[model samples]
Target: MANRFLSDLDPTTAWAKAAVDGKLFTCGELVRHAAECHLRDIRHGERRDRATPQRTSDNMQWIVNAVRSRTNCAGKILIEGASFSSSRNWVSNGQAAAFDRLYGPAGNIAFSPHSYYDADASGTDASCVAGAQNRLDPPLSWAAVGDREIFIGEQAGSGLDAVCQFVLPAAYAKLRDHPNCIGWTRWGGARRRGSTYAYRLDPSNYQTGEDTPQMKLLLRFLAQNP
Candidate 1:
C-alpha cells in the first residue's frame, strides 16, 4: 500500500469506509487485525505528507502500541522517515525526533525506504539519471544518526541495456556497502502475460520460466553479495 495520505487510513473517510465495507478493517482495528493475522512485517505508512508530521507520528505510535500490546504477534513494523521522493530534509527538520520518541527504543521497528534511480525517483520512468546511486546518501546519514537498521522496501530500474549494465550495479553497490541497510526488494514482479510494467522480473512464459534481464542481473548481484 502506498498509504500516501492520513485520510487513506482514517475510517471516517469515504475511501476508507469503502475499504471497511469490503472487510479490510473495522474502525481502530487495522493494526490489531494485522497482529492477529501474524504478518511478518507491517509497513504502517509510506511517504506520508511532510506537512502533517505530528499526525503521522501519532498514527505510527498507535501502530507501535497495538503491536507491543499483542503478545501473540511477533511481527515487526517498518517506517519511512521522509517523503518517498527524498529523505534529504528528514533528519534536519526534526522529523526523526518525532518518530524516535516512539520507535527509537523499540527493537521490533526499523526504517524502510523505497528508492528509485529515475530522474524524479518515482519509479515510473524507465530512463535513469547518471550517478543516481547517490540518492541513498541522505537516508544513509539519517539511519546512521539513530544507529537504526534499514530495509530498502522497494527498488528497481528497467530491463533496458543501459539500466541493467550501469544504473543497477551502482545502486546495488551502494546498498551492499551500507551496513545499516539490511537488504532490498526489487519492484515490478507481475506474472500476468500482458503486463506492461517496465521493471517486471517474471518470465514471459510460466512453463518456460525464462529469466528477464533484470532478474538475471539481480541473481548475479545476489550471488556476489551473498
Candidate 2:
C-alpha cells in the first residue's frame, strides 16, 4: 500500500495519537481532519479489538476528496467503502456508515458494498444488506446525495453457478431495480483462492483464460435489466 498509494499506516505515523498528543484540534476536528489518528489504514476486520469501528469510515471522507483531486481515474469510479469482517456479523454497522461516507461527497463516485460470506445465508442479498443497514437504514444521506448509485460487489464461493442462479437474482430483486446498480464484482476477478477463501469463486476454475460463469451471469443480468 505504501509503495503504491502511500496509504500504509505505520505505528509511528498514528493519526489518532497525533491528534491526542499534538493537542492541535478539538473534538470538532474529530470528523474531518487528522489522518494517522483516524486509523484510515485500519480496516473493518480489526474492529474486534474494540478501539472503535466506525472511526475509519468517518475519516475516509477526506481520503475520498484527496483521491479525486490527485488521481485522474477518480472520475466515474466505483469506490468500495471500508467493509466489516465478512466472516462475522460483528461489524455491519461500521460497514454501513462507511458505505455512506465513501460515496456521499461527489457524484463522480458510486458505492460498491463488498459482499463476502457470512453465516446469515443472505450474504450480499437484500436481507443481508438490510441487516447491515440496521445502524443506518437507507443511509440518511442517500436522498440528498443521489439515487441509482448503489452497487453490490460479491465474492461467491466456488459455487459460482449457485450464486449466479440464486444470489445474483435474489440480490437484484432485493435491490428493486435501482437502475444504477453495477450489480456485482467478483473478488480478485475470481482468483483469490489457492482456493481457500470462503467465496472460492476462483477465476481459474471457470475462466479458461476468457470465460467465467460469474461474469457471464452478471452480463446477462445487465443486458436484461438495461
Candidate number of the best lDDT: 1
Candidate 1 per-residue lDDT, tens place, 39-79, comes to: 11223432234234455566567667766774456666787
Off by over 4 Å in 2: 1-53, 70-74, 77-79, 83-106, 117-148, 157-165, 173-176, 188-192, 195-226
Instruction: Tell me which residue pairs clash in candidate 1.
Output: none
Identify the candidate with maximal TM-score: 1
Q: List the residue pairs that clash in candidate 2.
A: 14-36, 15-36, 15-37, 16-36, 16-37, 157-199, 190-203
Q: What TM-score against the true fold does each predicted structure earn?
A: 0.73, 0.47
Sliding window of 10 residues with minimal summed lDDT for model 2: 126-135
Single out the weakest 10-residue window by summed lDDT for candidate 1: 34-43
lDDT of 2 by residue, 1-226 (tens): 3322234344434445555455556533433345444354443234554224355454456556655554554466554443332313223446554454445345666555554432353343222232332222243235225553655544442235443455544554555444555455555433433444434343445556543454566557668777
Per-candidate Cα lDDT values, in order, are 0.65, 0.44
Residue 152 CA displacement from its true place in model 2, Å:
2.1
